[model samples]
Target: MVPNVRSSLPVTGTKPRTSWPRKALLILGFLFALAAIALVAMAVSQNKPLPKNIKYGIVLDAGSSHTNLYVYEWPAEKENDTGVVHQVEVCKVEGLGISGYSQDTEKAGLSLQHCMKRAQEVVPEQQHRETPVYLGATAGMRLLSLQNRSMADRVLSAVEKTLRSSPFNFQGARVISGQEEGAYGWITINYLLGNFKQAFSAFYFVMNFLNLTTEKSPVPLDKATSAVESFCSRPWHEVKAEFPKIKEKYLSEYCFSGTYILSLLENGYGFTMEKWQNIQFLGKIGSSDAGWTLGYMLNLTNMIPAEKPPTRPLSHASYVGLMVFCSLVLVAVLLLSWLTFHKPKCLQKGLI
Candidate 1:
């Protein structure tokens, strides 16, 4: 009875030792998870969309007195949206309006070459072919069309030819009606003032009276009228001496223009004496002129959408982040399951 030794002795409690292969597998899995997390972070940081792309457009406002080229720009992604398009540059063509070249219709087109070149310089070279260039002749061309329809057509054709030759996508040149001009002018002013997005029901009127009479007179109607008359009564030389900076041509017409504007507002538009205070004579709303050119472009390009576009709940970044988190959780669950189900046989036996 060797010290009454038991045939089967209870094994002492000992810690389970993991095999090198299992340890390596666990370390490799951890490293792989870290690499995956780093890869996701890199993708999120580096693979975002590029900077906002700018789109360009050109509008030629061929008024009764002169022609002006306006270069406009907006974000490319928001094409059919409002309050995005804005004027960048405005180049006035030297000499008279396109309609003035009725005698030598070919000169009408040539007159626009300078402004066209300016537009080319203003807009990026890559966007030339796609950039739409429009020519809108106002009262002058309308008057020309009334006086001589054939001549107006020829004048328009000449300008069209010139525009077509340019790198931009030339839209047709046409003489716009007074009503159309007024409506577009209204749109332009309101658009620049951001009235469309506001909660208001007030009506706005735009009078494309005369560009020469844009000088804002900060006085009552009667006083303004008397002042204009007094200014007109003075001798041309004396007036020129008093205001040397004023162009003689424009200076001479101030009285007539001032009177004409007053009459037009009071009689033509039917505004009362009290309502006169509401009249706002603005050459520009912001950087862009308060005129029909911007409205014309907006209509042609359908930049102002009829209805708001539908939107998703989550932002792009948020959606991506959510997806990456879900992917990581799934990978972790799979790795844990694999480690549990594919444990070494020795380790399983030791546990038992």
Candidate 2:
């Protein structure tokens, strides 16, 4: 039995299993390489501006004093976001506002033709069919509706007909409510200033402070602020009476417009009197005009998305730079590891 034992012994050639730590390191290295490649690709992609698909839209601010046609152009990619729309061109109609044509209601529609034609000139021909044109009559139309419903209807009908006849997609012409006009105006102003959400946060902060504080002095910061806001929210008539230096260059209907604005902030939107001081009543905020035209265009085309867009944790350039640095470190480590573990014994002895 002993004679055959040596010859019958099995010949084996099996590789040893990799240790858990070694396997983990290998996997981590592979992932690092993959991440570096991905970062590089992302950097390259971001470095080049993507082809912009330009979109066009038109909004007619049918205010009491005048009608203004604003042509807005934005990248199609950013259509579903706020503050992306910019007023490319503004065409002011020579005649009175749409409501001014109450007697000759047909002329109200005709007045918009020139503006719409100008819009066509500014917007590309291809976009005309797709471009939506909306007409939002302001205080003038609202007053007209209240005073003479038939005249207001006729004016709106006239404007709608004119818009429909044009090459652009005609949404409709209607008298926007005082609350909507005011709210949209607020949105426009805050959106332009990039303070829409910030304003709301400030309001909440003030409310919390009021709730938390036990001080009941009438002259407290919050009370003083509320008084100032109340003054601002007062109708223009009261303002003019209180401060005689306040001049009216435009139509004398500031009282009506201001009243509606106050209503919008106080009653419609439930903003307390204290918040009125924060709102801008002027025509312009910096270089841009603070009005509802921009907001209207943004809303009509669904430019503002309901959900916030996802943002990358790291910028493309930073990610790529980090990856590159890590890759170099990894290469150096690997080189050092090879030298430490795989160098020939004669070479190691000679180096020592």
Clashes of each: 0, 0
The residue-by-residue lDDT of candidate 2 on 1-352, one tens digit each, is: 3588766888685765558547656765676577567767766665665455677888888987689888887666563354377778888997888888999989998888887888999998987898888889987899999999988998898888889999998877888887787677667767777777623111222233223222232124445345446544677776567656433543233434434544555778776655544443245555555577776776665643333444465687887787677667667657655654577788768745
**Regions of candidate 2 where Cα sits further than 4 Å from its true position:** 1-50, 79-83, 197-281, 303-352
lDDT (0 to 1) per candidate = 0.74, 0.68
Which ten contiguous residues of candidate 2 have the minimum total lDDT? Answer: 200-209
Candidate 1 steric clashes: 0
